[model samples]
Target: MDSALDYKMVFDALVVPAAVLTPDFVIVAVNEAFLAVMGRTRADVLGHLAFTAFPDNPHAPNDPAAHGMQVLRASLQRVVATGERNALPLQRYDVETPGRPGVFKERYWSAVDTPVLGPDGEVKLIIHTVEEVTDFLHQLRRYGEREVDDTRTALEAVTTNVYARAHELHDLNERLKRTAGQQRQTMAALKEAIERQRRFVFDASHDLRNPITGLLTELEVALSEPSTDTHEILSKLLRDAERLNEIVADLLELARMDTATPGDAAELIDLGRFVVEELERRPLTAAVHTRTDPQVMVRASRIRLARLLGNLVANAERHTTTTIEIIVTTDPPDAVLEVIDDGPGIALADREKIFERLRRLDDARRKDPGGSGLGLPIAREIARVYGGHLYAADHPTGARFVLRLPLAT
Candidate 1:
């Protein structure tokens, strides 16, 4: 029941676009927003046919204006005749203001035309409403395009950093390869030095063995027939020469231990019986004693094990002020040998360093000037080869050296 003048007041207060048209489709009234969008005064749009607003005149500057208006008029005529609200989906390029430049966006209008009936039941006026939504459509497209560009830039930076790291890694690998080659060359030089040392010791000992035996044999014969004073001097010379031979023999044996692969082990040997038999050979002024748990056996290189026990026993005898104790015992998994002497003990500081080659704790108390410092070293190395160690143990009255060898079942 609203007249065009009453509808004008309601539409003016609305935030949306509204227009009233005559039955002939002439625009009779328009709100402030619709007039602003058309870019003309209310005088230009009011009393103007919807066709004139988007005119078909040949003089109109925009060429597509006539066709666009024709299509819109046909849609509007159907809505007015049927008294229905028709939603028109206009494409991006279809909806545009005539005579406007640089304009973008396709506007969509949810338009409705309601025909006011007259007393004679004939159409008197048509009402059309439009809502402008161009800004919303424009912002959506721009944000999506910007997002794609940002993603592409981020991916490019990651790829560039990865490529740079790969190049740096390749350079580092090349340096490591060069360093490895140099190390292998150094190792080869060390191997050659070891071979030369072994050959010299073996050759020198081999060459001296025959001459030494001959010298001692001839000296013994000469001493038996010589004058008294000269015999004493010759006897002393023979004794000194024998000591030198012993040193050379010990050194030569140790040098061979380096190149010597352990010989296959023989049947288990009774360590106690072996020590007892070895004792009969040594002429000790003090009583030498041997004690062990019954059935005590060691699986070791026979020659090396014999030499290891010999060095310990002789060391104890050389230094003992009184009785020397050689105790062989077993504790479940390892067999231990303790050689005790009552002589002056080595200083606490020198205990560890005294085992090195040529190290002597007390040069003044040396009973044997010809004693080569290889005995303990040789024993330790032999123990290591058999998977064990030699350590100086606590002795309340004197020096105690303990040899621990792994017992094999």
Candidate 2:
């Protein structure tokens, strides 16, 4: 009896919610725990269907229960044939008493069914065991919700980033298009200016040529006529006309200098020599002292550079009434030629605007314009072509013109 009871105790300890159903599908035996859960004694539960013993489900163990029992029979048949454990996991109601409806009083059941075979090689009984798994199911539901939220957040972030990048690209393209259009407009304006400059030069030359030829012809006729009071009058007229012809010639030469092309420039030029040559050629009332130092060479177009210096010296000679001094000064990054004269000084207010074409500051000079009003303009254009500039300096004594050119190669 002790040995038989020992086996029974061992089996009961290993089994959970253990019960046995007979070959005819009746609840033939149940463990002490199973009977306690039903609130019944061993005799009361024995020989009843498993559902009737529990009263939560009354059709089970007579006909197989719908949930696990339906799947259990096939597994149990295989178990009986092969002599191995067959498991069918399922859920079922295990209400404690009449007070509980859908809610179980103390039982939340997850069940697994296994077959118990007879000596005749058939399944005589089926064993069922259930565990309460309420906490485990709650954890599964929480994990599922977190996964869904994380996915939604990532999708929203990607969409917003794409929208921002698209807007930035659109703005950059618009700015690039505007810059290209402005460059095109600037090129068109430069072309138009060049065309107008060409037409002006052609017309000025044509108008001045006929009068110059007639004046020269009339001067020859006067020299042949005899010396008398009438001859003196004609002589004065011829001399004035000759001066006028010279002025006209100077005007035409200045215009030609304005439109001439720059050819190959020499590698180096002597600044002192250029100033000396220009001063010797110019006829002036006052002597200009040359402080030019010959060693100081400049990188310039020799032809254009010579003409530029001649025009500037002549301009100073025309303006100054008395003494003129030419100074050649060198600086750290540039070579400067300054022509300082004792003449009617230019007004401080008009110094800046006087460098423009045909802008003589004095009203008397404007009316008695002896030379073509093109000397300064010609000088300025020459300076620009050689990467230099010509500007007037305001002074208390007289006007100052400074020419700045690049240093020698």
Candidate 3:
């Protein structure tokens, strides 16, 4: 009999959700029960760090008691250090919905972490087991109502035992109060969820309407005017279709960014050199000048960084009169990159508003009717994810957009 096979069989046979992790918290393997409970597949989590695979919900409350990842990390660390099993208290850890980007389902869990020790008495691997308690918690909240009915029945039957009935009544009052509070919290959470969904639908539909309407109008005109040149009609249809495609692409990108977890694969990039290469690769209608400091370097994903730069440059091209300037410099612990244009500058009041989803100023609409209005938002999100910021700063001549990122250590 193969011992390894026997071990695997026993591990999979367990009825509860269980996963095996390395000492460094990397998910080495997960059982069927774990996959079912976590709403994930093996490919989604295997070989990834535990925290990275299941990140803490960014929308969760700021209370420490609601932070499941923090508690779980501490428990795992303790088990590794002491080489003993540890049971965690009830935790409210939400999980992302399977196949739905940017959607999370509320969840509660009761978990235990046990360490496997080697011959030398050091921790080898950690076995993490969890039981979902979300339903149970909901049921507990409803217990007060059920208890009240039973108490009323008892009070009627035990009229002679006044003292006993009085104590029962007092306890029931406390339970009812707690249940009322719980119900209020649940209602608040539901309201917030609905509002978020409503905003998302509205934003997507609002931007999509223009391109769809234009496409339909073009098709109708082509049908009504048979003498119109075939080449011109096809060109108009193609342009409308491309606009629709770009809007859809940008929406999908934003959704992905909303649910993305911080990655550990960042590399040090030379900001000045990177900017020069990106400009040379892309064709620009306006002349672009560069004032780069070679000493400015930052740690980031190359692809995402390039996208951020591209968005800034594209935005500048849309509004610049003739020339745009790209400046790279360092501000102590941060690397600063600024994109300045020679056209009309952004008003102080509209600086923040421009970053809102699908928000377009009057001038912007007049300049680029086909624009999706998502480029600046996407660029800002990327900057935020990298522990940086993108903002419009006061400039003497035109709109100046600045990006600041932590310098590479």
lDDT of each: 0.66, 0.63, 0.85
Q: Give me the runs in candidate 2 sitting further than 4 Å from their true place.
A: 1-165, 180-261, 363-368
**Candidates sorted by TM-score, descending order?**
3, 1, 2
Candidate 3: list runs displaced more than 4 Å: 1-197, 262-265
Residue 64 local lDDT, model 2:
20
What digit string (tens of lDDT, one per residue) describes model 2 on residues 305-390? 77777777776677777877788878747788888877786677876656554445564266345454556777787787777888
Off by over 4 Å in 1: 1-230, 262-267, 363-365
Ranking by lDDT: 3, 1, 2
Instruction: Give the least accurate 10-residue stretch of model 1, judged by summed lDDT.
Output: 86-95
Instruction: Give the candidate number with the greatest TM-score.
Output: 3
Q: For model 3, how does the per-residue alpha-carbon lDDT over 146-232 read when each residue is reduced to its tens digit? A: 677656544444432432443355356546656987999999999987886687679779888987898898889889999888898
lDDT per residue for candidate 1 within 222-271, as digits (tens), equals 66967556766576667667766776776766666677755646457676
RMSD of each: 32.9, 35.0, 26.0
lDDT, candidate 1, at 64:
30
**What are the clashing pairs of model 3?**
none
